[model samples]
Target: MSSLKPIRKAVFPVAGLGTRFLPATKAIPKELLPIVDRPLIQYAVDEAREAGIEQMIFVTGRGKTAIVEHFDVAYELESTMAARGKEMSALGPTRATPGDIITVRQQVPMGLGHAIWCARAIVGDEPFAIFLPDELLIARNGGAGCMKQMVEAYGEVGGNIISVLEVPRDEVSNYGVIDPGERNGALTEVRGLVEKPPVEKAPSNRILSGRYILQPEVMRTLERQGKGAGGEIQLTDAMATMIGNQPFHALEFDGRRFDCGSKLGFVEATLTLALERADMGADVRAMAERLLNA
Candidate 1:
């Protein structure tokens, strides 16, 4: 088999107003909202890096300066650490070199398709990965790092790869369902993709999670794609058109995904991550027990 093209660039769609978060998000972008110490967006970037992505491109909107700043170097902080001679142990592996990440603007709030299209100039001509920060996944050995696993699979198969999971038939209305044409272990060939089909009308139980590895041609389709559901450009519609042209598949991940976009998912991610932390686990567990008793 011919070796698959390596995916080095990653696109993050970070333009939403985060109205769901209201007051808090009024000042802070939801992507910058903290899950433990790291922001939601950082987890996505870290996941992409783990999957061997070299360039990071963010499609951000208004009032998102903080998101850009977060990835930028903290010179004052690093200087203080250096002065204290704690740079080695303190800023060690966590410190990322400058220019490792870049940012671009999405002036319009058209849709996911538009957000991705905004990165076209930076993305150039390469197969790229897109990870939605709202879906926070936690794995054991993988540690919510589904994209890393998908990248490994892509190296072998060489096509568009989407991370998916089986949801209940009723829940299928909430996501894009994969039409599995063929299967290879966790990898399933995608014959078609339907976003939010009715419970009784779904082709399969497989739901498209927030992870995607798409070919460059996808942007062209998105450019021509008219408004879809919600009167906005939909990425699903663009992917549906590419099914017959090239290989498209879904990889069922070995991890738990938390929908941090919703309140419940955010709370769950917070509590779960806290429980996994060595320093906070014992105390959080005690607090949970107290709440249960009350």
Candidate 2:
């Protein structure tokens, strides 16, 4: 398994319609929706970069060009800021070099699996990562980002690695649960995966946390994959097929994750990150107290 190639590329499936966000997303991509000052896609991209991934592949849709432009140089604004001696250091991550970033179109609003498949031509035959921008991960106490942790684990056991988190047993029904096996510290061998199984038939309380390091072979499985839930090609269903053939493992994320796809989660992520910022922490705390007491 040591012969496994290093994960140099990561796919961001940002083509979702994001109907949950309504009119705001009607005109704009949900990935551009900010957690605070930075957009959700930026958090996901930063996490990929933290893991030493070289190329960032965005599987995008129409009206998602803004997501692409977010990484482009803002000549006018950047030049003006530089002329005024404003700190332009923070813009480094937004600028992507020529081959470092690539975009592929996923015209139809398919499922997560279809969105990822759109990047297969770009991905080639190498191992890659998948980052769902809506699932924003925050490293606790300045630890490694979620994807970094998974990439590290992948170095140890190289086949497939997915980020996992323990939730309530009853709540497992709401998520894709893994049938866990052979545990070594934070890493657990994934014996099987079940997507949104009923509570009575749930296998484990651990849910997939939207970060994945997958072998390219899974793309073959998805080629002829059929629709599962909601008439969409489910990524989980395709992943489950590789359990016996490949070494599948899950890392219990050493941090918190915010499902920013939901309105409540988006609000919570914004407030949480705001309260952690040095410039706004005190003010946010005061605002929270005032609101709670009001």
Q: Cα RMSD (Å) per model? A: 1.9, 1.1
Question: 1-294, model 2: which lDDT tens digit per residue?
Answer: 578699999999988899999999999899999877899999999999999999999998888899889999999999999999999888888998888889999988778889998899999999999998989999999999998998888888899999999988888877889999999999999999998999999888999999999999888988999998779888999999999998999999999989899999999999999999999999999999999999
TM-score of each: 0.94, 0.97
Query: How good is model 2 by TM-score?
Result: 0.97
User: Which structure among the candidates has the greatest TM-score?
Assistant: 2
Against the true structure, candidate 1 reaches a TM-score of: 0.94
lDDT of 2 at 96: 89
Per-residue lDDT over 1-294 for candidate 1, one digit per residue giving the tens place of the 0 to 100 score: 355678899999998999998998999999989898778987887788888998888888889988888766678988887899773442343445676677889887888888898888887778999999998866675354798998888888887999998876778998888888889898999999988788898999999999999999999998888988778888898999999899899999899989999988999999999998899999999999999999
C-alpha lDDT of candidate 1 relative to the true structure? 0.86
